[model samples]
Target chain A: MQGVRIQQEMSLFEKLNILSDAAKYDVACTSSGTDRRGDGKGIGNCKAAGICHSFSADGRCISLLKILFTNECIFDCKYCINRASNDVKRASFTPDEVCRLTIEFYRRNYIEGLFLSSGVLKSPDYTMRLIYETLWKLRQEYHFQGYIHVKAIPGASQELIQMTGFLADRMSVNLELPTAESLRKLAPHKSRKNILGPMRLVQNKREENKQEIAVYKHAPRFVPAGQSTQMIIGATPESDYQIIHVAESLYQKFQLKRVFYSAFIHVNEDASLPARTDEGPPLLREHRLYQADWLLRYYHFSASELLSEKQPNFNVLLDPKCDWAIRHLEWFPVEVNRADYQVLLRVPGIGYTSARRIVKARKFGSLDFEDLRKMGVVLKRALYFITCKGRMMYPVKMEQDYILRNILDPREKLPGGLGEMGYRQLSLFDDVNFREVKAE
Target chain B: MLKRRFICTDTTIGILSAIYDAWKMDRTDTEAGIPLWGTVQHEMFCEYYEVEENERKAGAVRKLIRERLGKQAYSDISYAILSKDEDKGTAILQTMVAARELADSHRIMEHLSHPAVRRVFEMSRNVGREAHYWEEFLRFREMKPKILYAEITPQNQVLPAIADHFADRFPLEDFVIYDKNHASYMIHPRQKKWMFMTDHEQKWEAAKELSEEEEAWCTLWKGFRKSISIKDRENKKLQTQNMPLRYRGDMPEYGKS
Candidate 1:
C-alpha cells in the first residue's frame, strides 16, 4: 500500500466536497434518541424524534452532516474507495476545520448533528484522536449541544475512546463482516476482535457512566444515545441465518442500540472480486434483513424464528411477520378482543401501536373488523389471522398452501413492490456479485 | 319553528364558549339541537346567539372537564379544537357531555362505536400526526447571525405543538417558523419566551437572501443530498412517501429542482 499524499492545495469547500462525497456510502445517518433542551448558554438542542433535515436522492434521511475526517488511509481494504492503494485524491480536515463546519452547519440548521467517521489516516489512534479533538472543540468551545455520532475506530486506544464516548451522543464500531473468517478474507487489515474490543469497552463504560449519572446528577453523559453497529450485507458469503445470529449476539452480548445492514455496491475492479451485474446492489436482500431486524427489535421475534438452517433466508414475496405466521398456521385466527398484546403482535397486519390500540380499545366495547380497520390494522393481511368476536372477516381455510396462494394473489394490495418482485428461489451456487462494503 | 344557531369566534376559547352555550340547551331533545357555527358562516332565518370569547366561561368548562374527565381528555379536546374539521366543535361538545356521564372518560376515548368520541379521537389523531410531521419537516435556514427562519404549509394548525420543540432545540438562537396555510408564526426569541402569533394582518415574506455562510452551507447541503444516493437504487416513490412533495419547496435540495 502506498503512503497517503495529503493535498495541500485543497480549499475548505474543496475538502468538504471531497470528504462528504467520500463519506456518502456509509448508511448509518440516523439522528435520534437524545432529547436535550438547549441550555441558555448553548447553541442547539436535540429532539428524541430525530429530524430529517433533507432527503437524498436514494430516499435516505440526511439528518446529520455526515463527512469523513479524512479520505487518506494506511490500510488497503479492498471494499473501500479510500483504501491506501486507491489513487483517490486524499484530504484530511484539521480538528478546527471539522469544528467550524459542524458549528456553522448546525447553526444554519442544515443538519441535526455531526456523523464523523474516518479512514485510517496513519493509525487508528491518530485518526481517533483527531476526531476526539474535533468533538471536544465542538462541545466545549463552540458550546454546540446537538447530537454527535462518532465512530470508535477498531484498535484505537481505550482512553481515547472513553474520552470520545464522553463527548459523543452515540458511538459505534462497524463489524463489517458477520464472521471473523469473512473479515480476514475481505478486509485483511481488520479483525473481528479489534472491532468488538472497542465496542465492548464502550458498552461497559456507557453502563458504568449511566450508573454514575443515576447516582450523581452532574456526571456527564457517556454516549447517552447508546451504541450501534453496521454490517455490510451481500459482500460476504454469510447466510441470512449467520448475519442475524451475529446481530442477535451483538444485541445480547454488547448491548448495541442498532445493527444497520448496508447493501454492498460493487466498486473496485479486482480479479479476486466478483464481476458486477446490472442487477446492482442486493437492495431487496438488504430491505428484507432490515424488516427482519425490526421484527427482532420491536416485535419480540427471535432471529431463529424468522429464519433457520432449513430456510436460511427471508421470502422476497412476503414480509418476515407474515411469512412466519403462514409457516406456523396453528396460531392463526387469533381473537382480536381476547388476545393478549404479545399474541396480537404476532398477527401479520397488527403492528406494535395497532396491537396496543386493540388491547386498549377492546376493553371499552366489542371490536369488529370495521373497528380494527379504523385502528390502522391492514385487514387484507390480518383477516386471515384474526377473528372479531368468533367470526372471520371471510371464511378462510387454515391450509398453508391455500393461504399463501390467496395472500400472494394480485387482487390483495400487496406490500410495496413485492407483487412485482419476480419469484426466484434462494440459490446456493449463484455467483455472488462483488459489492464494495465499507465498515465505516 | 325557531332555529337556535350559536355564532362564535374561530378559536379554542370561542369554541369552548359555544360548546358551553350549546351544552346547556336541550341535553336530550332532538328538535332543540343547537347547531354551532363559526363567525365565517352566513345562515338566514336562524335566531343567532352570539357567544363571545370569555375566559371565565371557558375556564369553567375546562374545570368541569378536568374534574369529570382526565387531563388526557382535556388535552384531547384541546388538540381536537385545532383541527380544520367543521364539525369538531359539536363533536367535542357531545363527547364532553357523554364523557361526563361515563365512569371513565379516558376509557370512553377508546369506544370507537360512539360517534362523538370517534370524531374527537380522529380529529386529535390528525392534529397529532401533523404536529409530528412538522417536528421533522420544519427546516430553519439562517437569515442572520443568530436568527433562523423556515416556512411550512401543514394541513392542520400544528404550530403550537412544534413551537416548544424548536424553542427547546435552539435556545440561544432566534427562529421564526411561519405556517403559511394557517397564517400563524411560531417565534422564539434567543434566550427568551416563544409564542404563536396568529396576526395574519401582515403578510410574511421569505428571507430575501441567505447569508454568505448560510448560502455555502445550503450549497454544501445540496451537494451532499445529490452525492448520498446510490443511482442504481433511486426510489422516487419511497422518497415522496417519506418526505411529501408539499415540503419540497422549502428544502434547498428540492428548491432548485
Candidate 2:
C-alpha cells in the first residue's frame, strides 16, 4: 500500500488534512482514563472517562484524531458520501504518512491518538489490511503507545480481524442497520452476515483474551478497550422493539463495550429513504432510545419492559420509564423507605444517583413527600406512585392515563410560558437559549 | 456590580485562584466572584460573577478538594467548569457547595440527584465525555515548522483542561484549539498563552490554511461521510445529536461544498 502511494509528494499536513477529516465520523474513538501509566519510557496514558479536546455540536465528544485511511471506498451505500457511485473527490494515506501524522499530532499534544477507519477501498480484506498495517507501524517502528481504534471491515478475513484484536486497543464492526432486511435495503452491498461475521469473530477473540488473562494474569492482548458496534437508528423501519432486541443480543453475545446508536442521515435523498418534513430529524426519538439504552445497560429494564412487538414505537410524549411505570401500576406505590434499590430505581424521575440517595437518606430519616423531594426525587412522576409515611401525597383514583397526563403534560411546564415542548420538554430552540434560561 | 482585577499566570490557575478567593471571602447566598465580563477591564454583574482568582488561595482550594472531595472530584469538577457549555462555571459552584454537606467524596454523586447538583453533574459528565471524545476526535496537522493546528467546536469549555492534558502528554508540541463560540487559543508547551482571552479576537482566513493536498483530503472525508449507509436514516435524530450542526463549520466531513 505504501509502495502504491507517493509519500514524498505528500507532506504531514496533507496527510492530516485528508486522513483526520476522512476519519472524523467514525464513532469508536474514545480515550477514557487508561489513567494507568506510560510503562517506563513508552508514551501516552488513558483517562478513565477519557480526556476531550473538544465536542461536536450534536454534543458528541471528540477526543482522538478520528479519520479514515482514505475517503475512497468501493461500496455505494445509499447513505454514504464515499460510496463508489458518488461523484466525490478521493484521497488515501500511506502507512508512514499516518504514522508520522499521528506521532506529530501526539507529540504536539493535538490529539490523544488515532481513530483510523476506511471507506471500504478495494475489498473488505484490503481495507482492513491497510488499517491493520497502520497500527503495526505506529506500534512497532514508531513505538507509538497512544490508543488506537481500528474499524473492523465487515466481511474482512478472520485473520485480518484477529490482527485488529491483537494490535488495536479497540475494534468495531458497525451494525449499519438495526435489522437484517434494512441492512439489505439501505446498504445493499452490506448484509447481516457480512457485518455480524466480523462482529462474532471479534467477540470470540475478546472472550478468549479475557479467559486467557483470567488464568494467566497476563495474556496476549485483544482489543483491551474491547469491541463496540454502532446501530443506525431511524434510517429504516425498525421498531424500538427491533432495535432493543438487537441491542440485548449484542450485549449478551458480544460483551461489547458499547453499542452506539448513530441516527441515519439522508445523504443522497434516495427515493427509498423516508422524507422528514417538519423536523430535520427525530431528536426526541433518539433521546428516548438513549433513555431506553440506559435502562438496558444500567437500569434493570429489559427490552420487553421498554417496548413490545405490539407497541412497535415508544410514546413520543412520555419517557420510556414513565411509560413503563404507567403500564405496570401494581409495581408502583411501593414504600420508598423500605423498597429495594432496584425498586426505587424503577420510579420515574429517579436515576442511579437518586436511587442511592433514597437508600442513604432513608437510613437517616423516614422519607416522606418533602423528604423525597429534598432527597432529589422529582415528584411529578413519582407523586402518584409513592407515599409519604404511609400516606399517599393526594391520593384519589389510580388511573394510569390520568397520572400520565400531568407528568407527561407539556402545557403547564417550562419557565416563562413555553408551550408544549419536544422530547426533553423544553421549548423549541432550548439549546440556543440555554444561557438565557440559566440567567432566569 | 463592582470590577476588580488580579493577574495570574494562565486561565485554569486564574479561575482556580478566583474560586479560592470566593471561598475565603465567606460570602453568603451569592458568591464573591470576578466577571469574566468587562471588555479590557475585569468587573461586575454578569448573568453571574466569574470568581476572583488567587494563587495561594487557588492552591489551597486544590488541596481542600483533594482532601474533602478526593482526587477524582478535583479533576472531575475542574474539567466540568472548563467545558464549552456557558453554564460550566456556575454549575460547578453549585455542585461543589452541595457536595460540601457530605463528608465522603462519593456522596457528591448523591447530591447530584438534586436539580442544581444534577446540572453540574451533567456538566461534569458532559465535559468528561467530551474530553474523552476530544482526546480521540481532534484532527491535527503540522502547519509549518512547528505549528500544530487543530480546530474544534465543543458545547463545553473543554479546551483548557484538554490543553493541560495535551501539554503534559505532548511537552514538545505547540498547538492551538479554536473554540468557535469564543476565540482560538495560541497554545504551545514551549510558551503557553498565559492570560484570560477576555479581549480575544477571531481570524478565520481559509485560503492560507488549506494547501491543495489538504483540500483533497477533506474532499475525500466529505465524500466518505456521505456513503456509509442509508437504511439507518431513521436514526438521523440520533446522528444530529451525536454530531450537532454548530460543529459542521469545522468538521472536515461537512466542509463548504
Candidate 3:
C-alpha cells in the first residue's frame, strides 16, 4: 500500500481534476435504462435511451458528471492507483459542491446526470452515508429528476444500502476481478463475498419495491434502472470462457442490467500483477468480450455455446458472430422471405432490428436483395448466409474455407487495432503468393 | 397524357396543400408529382401549376391521412416532410398514393417493396436520427439575464422536431434555440409551451454575451472532460467517430482547444 498525501484548501477546479481522474478507471458511465419525466417542479428529467453530450479523446461517452466524492481510501488494492500505499494527492467534495456541479452541467446540456463514486474513507458506512446525504440533497432539496448512478459500497449496512437505492436510478458494486482466487490475490482487503452481499441486497429490495409499486401505484423505486457491476479484464489469469460464465450467472441469478469489462491498464508495479508490456491494455480482447456479452444478452447465446473448454478464447481476427457462423456452417443459406425471426438473427450481417424489420416487411410482400439493403442489413456479409426467393445472391460456394477467405477481406473495416491483427492472419496465406512472386 | 406537377413552398402546409392538389388531380403514382416552389426543374411534357398553399386545403389533407393511413403513418409522413431531401414532397405524395392500393391503408409503411414508400421511410429515419443527434450534441450557454440560449446548424429543419423534448425537460427555465440553417427560433418561456418562429430579425452579437457565472462553469466542465479521459487509451479516430467534427463547434470542451 502507498501513502496518500493530503492536500490543504484545494479549490473546486483542482478537486474536480483530482477526483474525476481517480474515478476514470471505474468503467460504467452510462445513464440509460430509466425514463423519468420531470414533475413540473424539478429541474431535470431522464431519457430511457440515455443521451451522451460529448465523447472524450479516449472515445468513451461523457454521459455523466463522473466524479469521486473523495480520493482518500483505507484499502490497498494492488491494481488501483488510489490505494493507501501510493503517494497521490487527495481531495474531497462537499455534498453542496456535487449538487451544484450536477445541476449546472446538466442545465448546460454537458451531461445527462451525475455518477457519484467514492473510496472507502474511514469506513464503508461513513462513506455510504455521505453519498446518501448528497443524493438526498440533490433529489429532495434541489429537486433534480435526472439520472443518478451511485456506487453501493461493499460491506455497507443493509439498511443504508436499501435507503440509498430508492434515491438512485442505478446502483453498482464492483466485482473487481472475475474469480474469488484472483480477487484475493490482487485485492487483499476485499473479498468476493463482501461484494456480492450488497448486490444481492439491492436485487431483493428492487423485487420488493416492484410489488410495492404494483399495489400502491407510486412507491419510490429502488434502483429503478436496475443494478450493474464491472470487473477488470486481463487482471487475473481467467479465460474468456470463465469470465463470461461468471457474467451469465450474475445476470441469471442476481438479474444485473449490465456487466462491464475494463481492459486492465497497468497503473501500479506490483509483484502480484502482470508485468508491464509494450502492448497496451488488452482492448482487442475486451472488444471481443463485449461482442460475446451482447451475444449472451440479446442474441440468445450461452457462454458454453460461444466458447467451451476446448476453445476458451475468442478469435482475434473475426467477430464472435462471424466466427460462430463459420464454425457452424450448417445453419447457412436461410431463406430471407420465409425464415423465422430467430433464424434471421443468426445470420452474419443481420442485426436484431433488421431481423424485426424483415419479419414485418415480408408480411406485406416477399423481399429481395435490394429491399434487404434498404432495411439496414449489411449485404457484404449476409450475401453468403441468406437467400432471396430461394436463390442465393451469387454463385459463391458454401465451403467454410472459401467463405472465410472472402469474409476476411481487407476492405472490411475492423475495430481499431484489430485491423493489424487481421492483416497478420492474411499474411500467413500471403507467404505462398510471395514465394511465387520470388520464383518469377 | 403528361404528368401534372404541383409546385409549393418547402413547409408542412405547403407540402400538404400540394399533396391535396395532386391527390385531387390524380390518385395514380405515375401521373402526379409535387416539387418545392423554388427548386422546380422544368420538365418537358409536364404541366406545372403553383399550389394555393392555404391552411384549409392542408388541413383537409392532414385529416384525410390521419383518418385513413393511421397515426403511425401520419407521424412518419410528418417527419419525412422535415427532411432535407429535395424530392421529399414527391416521395411523400407517391407514398400516400400507394397507400390507396393497400388492403389495410394503415399498413402502407410496412410495404417496403414500393420504392416511393421506401423513400419516405428512409427520409423519415434520416430526419429522426438527425434530430436525435442534435438532442445529444446541442450545447446551451446561459446568456445575460439568466436565459439559456443555443444555436445549431443542422441540414434538416429539426427545430420543431426537438422543441418538445427540451421544453419538457426545462419547463422552469426560459430558453431559445436558434436554427441557423433554417433561420428559425424555438422559443419557450418559463412554464409555457414552446412555439416556433421563422423569418425573424436576429442580432447574433447580443446572444454572445454570457452570464457572469457561465465562463466559470464552462471552464470547470472542460477540465472535468479532460481529466475523465484515460491517457493510455487515447484514440482520436474513435473520438471523432462518436462525436463527429461538425458537432464540436458549439461544445465548450471542443471549442478552440
Interface RMSD of each: 1.9, 7.2, 0.7
Tell me model 1's lDDT, rounded to 2 decimals.
0.81
DockQ, candidate no. 3: 0.80
Residue-wise C-alpha lDDT for candidate 3, range A1-440, written one tens digit per residue:
97465447989999999999999999999999988888888788888999988898899999999999998899999999999898888899999999999999989999999999999899999999999999999999999999999999988999999989989999999999999999999999999999999999999999999899999988788999999999999988999999999999999999999999999999998999998987789888999999999988988888998999999999987899999999998988899999998888889999999999899899888999999999999999999999999999899899989999999888766776564454344454444566777899
CA shift of A36, model 3, Å: 1.8
Report the C-alpha displacement of residue B39, candidate 3, in angstroms: 1.2
Greater-DockQ candidate between 1 and 3 = 3
Task: Compose the digit string of candidate 2's lDDT tens values, residues B37-148.
Answer: 3333433453333445556766786787777777666767776656545444445555566666665645565543455555656667777777655655566554545455
lDDT for A76 (candidate 3): 93
Name the better of 1 and 2 by lDDT. 1
The residue pairs found clashing in candidate 3 are A1-A85, A2-A84, A2-A85, A2-A86, A3-A85
Q: After superposition, how far is residue A172 of candidate 1 from its true place, in Å?
A: 0.6
Q: On residues B10-57, what C-alpha lDDT tens digit does candidate 1 reach at each position?
A: 677888787677767755422222244532465556666778769887
Name the 10 consecutive residues with the lowest summed lDDT in model 2 chain A: A412-421
Report lDDT per candidate: 0.81, 0.66, 0.91
- Highest-DockQ candidate: 3
What TM-score number comes out for model 1?
Answer: 0.91
| Candidate 2 ranges beyond 4 A from true positions | A1-35, A40-43, A103-110, A141-143, A215-220, A269-279, A367-381, A391-397, A409-440, B1-168, B171-257
Candidate 1 residue pairs in backbone clash: none
